[model samples]
Target: KSPQCTPDQHLQTQSETQGLESAQVTKPVEETLSSLSALLISATANPENVLIDALDRKVAFLVNFLLMKYRMKELVRKADIWKMIIQDDEDHFHEIFLRACEHMEMIFGLDVKEVDPTRHCYGISIKLGLTYDGMMHPPEGLPKTGLLILILAEIFMNDNCVSEEEVWKVLSKTKIYSGQMHFIYGHPKELVTKYLVMEKYLEYRQVADSDPARYEFLWGPRAHAEVRKMEILEFLARVHGTEPQSYPSQYEDALRDEE
Candidate 1:
């Protein structure tokens, strides 16, 4: 989830140098990407134990971005006006997402592709789960990782699996700016850093589309309410399991209640 800046007023010029856009934006993503060359050279073991330090230098830029955007936020005097413009759900989030993609392409090794908002939901849902909250339109109220952590939970809660395709499709939607060579909102380097941070919980699982009906139904503004009801009941019923046998009985009982 995106962290709220300390405040536009609190940010200082010294702090701006610490943010994400300083170097990685100017250099190649691989140049900024972590490598095991040093670790490999130092190792005596037959097989080098090279740990991939994804962010070796990523945070320097991300922090700066937050600060840059924070200062920009301060330039606007109207509090409500700022809220409408910068909230995660607003189009501004998309702008950030687009800028972020600029850095993501190089760091994460993504190829350009078209994103189907429905299919892309998996990855977007994961990131946004951490950013915007269903309960709180502005999750700035939550802990630093609160929105981020909950997003990891909500996204992986269903199945602990992420597909590269899912990630690629979503990243495809971001706009790449030529000038900064990073996200207009933040750094691309954070793609690897944030992914590394969230990876432990986001183990990918295969989502099956065995049924034609299941494939046909996904996200929609007017999704079938009855189907949604069944999904809620079924998901809840599945969670009620203590043992395999009793779960069948619980499922039946739950279905009856839903009916």
Candidate 2:
């Protein structure tokens, strides 16, 4: 027969087992803290990296703020930006603002124009003559720049005008159907027929003396002023992986228009 274990021995064994379990649990936590401390040390060693990282965050914040203003059709003020982002840091304000503006222009195809120097009021506008808005992978509150480009190109390709039906046909091919909700563009029909019309990007009007009163789309005054036929042709060429000269008639027409 085996000897019975004493109460003290049993208590001691339980204590040892508990100690071992506690150590096992604590080891990973200690290791994680050590790793984090090393990372912090490495980051602190490179001041430039820290500065760049901070600046990038500020720039991203400013871009998102400006995009929000654009979506709301509101003007941005220098004072407001300083108050919001710069806070008591006037020394870095100019650098941050310039970087943010450059990012806005390069990535969103937006121009941060100073509308009023005295009041320090700024207005955002789309870049002229460029169909691409760098919106291939847009962040929050993405604009409908790509859709606008496609519609403008379609109109240019179809002899400077296209019927509403034809416009819908082209848009449908891109999975943007009329009266349907798109993740990015909202309602395609309303966006095209109403908002774009109001913005003077496209002129939608009743076709000439049609019995059923069909509508047609034409390049609006704003579109004509902002973009050119050649630019539109080049945009199309890029999309098709071909040269603008591939379409001889359109190329000639663009040249004549340019001349």
Candidate 3:
């Protein structure tokens, strides 16, 4: 003899039964998580293993390749996978990743296009260009960092050597007045000491006989490696309205030497 049950009461009973069955089904999966974690710990315990190390390095390489080939936003759809795979601090990952890119660029001439400018996807470094006349030019509409560095470099192009104090004096005399007495902050001498010297845009050498603070700066490896003599000569020709063939004797010699 069963009591009559309303439709609502029957539905509630059914729901409760379904919940119990679902929990029972999930119980094994929940229990296995701890075991899975322990197994993972055991697998990764010997980080020095050749295979494990190889796999770790390969994973890092692949991650960099993907980031370079595809826009970051497109690749980040699987952020969870990245989080687990990277397993390092974001800054560390980026530092290694950049070094990997720079290495590839140096060895294989491979450039990474990680961003779609119109799509608002990724951040990229803007390259500063030096015109033939040795003008430090950024792309249009960007803040100007001045041509003091480039001008200094150009003046010393032939011998490619100068003292820091001499450069500072020249820079101090040179003025850029776009507005009412807007001065360039930070002495050029200090800028050379702090950044250019370390970046290898300019090579600095000091001898025991020389002044302690006085270091001679010359064009660094990067200057020769990146800036072609032909390009500079071409720019000069354009600026001066002369044929590339009839350039200055020094520039002509440079071109021939480079060739």
Candidate 4:
């Protein structure tokens, strides 16, 4: 592994980053970020090698692609990536999405539980390309969170039938029964957003949402409690199914300790 001092040191981070046309340097970094994402596609895939410290697996992914750009092979060479993506991981789904975010920037647009205690989750989404059979996908390595995909699919479906305003209104509706219903299903608060409500109430309300020009924290996290009432035991069971039992709920607890 490379030294964790790229911010302060002037050395090439990896072989992929070592040589490049000045114009193509960013390409290698991006490719390195995309390699090794294929490891997450199967039941046998290993993520332990993905992130070891602060360094993201994207480093490996980017390097792999940078090394093989001329070969023209697909990112997920065996199974169609889209098919794997559509099959949701019901537990630790957010954990999966965070992995994808390292390789793909597009997935970075959706919301989840934020690390900050003071922050409330917000609703946000974006889809690039207007093809009719358009697929919503994350960067090469990101695992899809079932909840995020459901929200995107619903919104995408709505795009074909209703105005964006109508879609947003319906998805953002907060009902009196929301708490009661949380016993069986997780509330959609973190995954769905009321842009108007978010803009008016959250502290960073004025910050621009993601777009071409800015590094936006487009999505935010919402605890099940903020928008639902499930027992903690159920929550623990679901998250642990996807998370390693060895360090289960580490990220979830990070949210609490930050409090």
Candidate 5:
């Protein structure tokens, strides 16, 4: 017969086996617990990121919608934007709309102005003092507002009038040639000499008694009505990273113009 085991010995052996099984079981449980903890942390951290991403998507949608309305020459109603993007988030309508407007102005050089406060209707216009022409054809053309501003600034700098040659020289530095069709602003020559003139933002006229029939640019009636000298000076100063008063002559002239 096989050797007989004592009862205590059998009990001890059984307990040891159970202990080994317990050890084996504990490790996987601990690993599972750790994984769950990591998942919880990740879930907790993701809400803010998710919110930001959602907000950005909404703002983009609103921007594209606004651009579409502007291209179609339709009035933008606040209710429509709310319906499209902020359907249930009524509290965040203003915030989202503000962000969209800021994006339009900053990126596309466009402004969303409140055309009808009672009806909450808005209209798109070119930034930097252009309140006319909401139709930026093709809806994808790059804005010419910046170029217009630069031209206006040049005119202001050159004793309130700038010659065609001088303007072309300045534009050449920006890689904009006269006759070439630019990818953004179409033909620079026609844009400057015709469209802007027709818009009443620039006055291009033949210089008096020039044998070659030269032209000069001056601030048109619309420019005078829409923008002030000080505002342009401040814009230039901001570009140069200086105060508007740094240019003493222009500053004084701007001050007088303000008065």
Candidate 6:
């Protein structure tokens, strides 16, 4: 879709920019930039026929100008869009284009989302929004099993490890264990194990080679990508009035006791 700005609006903006009456012969830089942004958004939404010449000289020049004015190189690094607009040794300009995407909140970043627990799979999500909801509930696509795994990860954030038995104990403390302990197809705890293993959201390794080997769980790639230590600490501080400073000491004690 084209830009929603009317011709009159564009003319007024152009006139303001030039301090002269708008002319039909020459388009103002502001109008060009707005049109470029609209085209980019449209291209993003329509992958099959995306405009390939988005990096043409005119668009590139405008993108570079905007980036330099905003000073947003670091956010571009986080968004990870270097390959899109990179040309020759013009790495600096590519980063600006990327940072613009992030600043607009059109392409925020990767977030891990659990899609199916019974099938044991997860999906990568693009985080997009101006406001955060605070991690009160599991993210939209996360399954119940994924939620349990995430809770276990947060609980063992300090030590970075938990035994299978300890995980069960933590799960038991939840209301699900008391009143609702079953899924339609199988048990809830088993679903948690399957989901975590399938998605690699939690690592499961045997402690020994035995008939019934004991296992330990650790945060996996998805967990590391999505959850942060500070997030867990902040959540605990808000919920339990727990001091953030106490975590390290408590974690140390737990580690020693585990040993």
Best by TM-score: 5
- Evaluated against the true structure, the overall lDDT of model 3 is 0.39
Span of ten consecutive residues with least summed lDDT in model 3: 133-142
Per-residue lDDT tens digits for candidate 2, residues 1-259, read 1112223355365555433423332333234333323333443465655543555556656766887898787999998898777787778888888867755543345778999999999998876554434233323367666567667766666556666876776566455689888655667787789877877888998766677788778877778777888877775565356799977777997898698
Q: Compare candidates 4 and 5 on lDDT and give the better one.
A: 5
lDDT of 4 at 47: 58
Clashes of each: 17, 0, 0, 16, 0, 0
Q: Give the Å error, residue 125, model 5.
A: 5.3
For lDDT, candidate 1 versus 3, the one ahead is 3
lDDT of 1 by residue, 8-28 (tens): 244354234322221212233
lDDT of 3 by residue, 1-259 (tens): 1112223354365555433422322233233322322333444465564344433353345434443433332422234334554555554555545544443222122333445545433332312243221112222222122232333334333233444444443333333122223222233444455455555555666622554444555666655565555654554444345666763553665676477
Range of the 10 consecutive residues with the lowest summed lDDT in candidate 6: 20-29
- Predictions in order: lDDT: 0.29, 0.65, 0.39, 0.27, 0.65, 0.40
Off by over 4 Å in 2: 1-140
lDDT per residue as tens, model 4, 41-100? 322336574434222333333223322321232233212222333233335334444554
Which residue pairs of candidate 3 clash? none
* True-vs-predicted CA distance for residue 143, candidate 1, Å: 14
Write the number of the candidate with greater TM-score, choosing between 1 and 5. Answer: 5
Model 4: residue 164 alpha-carbon error in angstroms = 34
Q: Model 5 off-target regions past 4 Å?
A: 1-108, 111-125, 133-142
Instruction: Give the better candidate number (1 or 4) by TM-score.
Output: 1
**Candidate closer to the true structure by TM-score (higher is better), 2 or 4:** 2
Q: Which model scores highest in lDDT?
A: 5
What's the TM-score of each model vs. the native? 0.21, 0.50, 0.36, 0.19, 0.55, 0.37
Q: After superposition, how far is residue 159 of candidate 2 from its true place, in Å?
A: 0.4
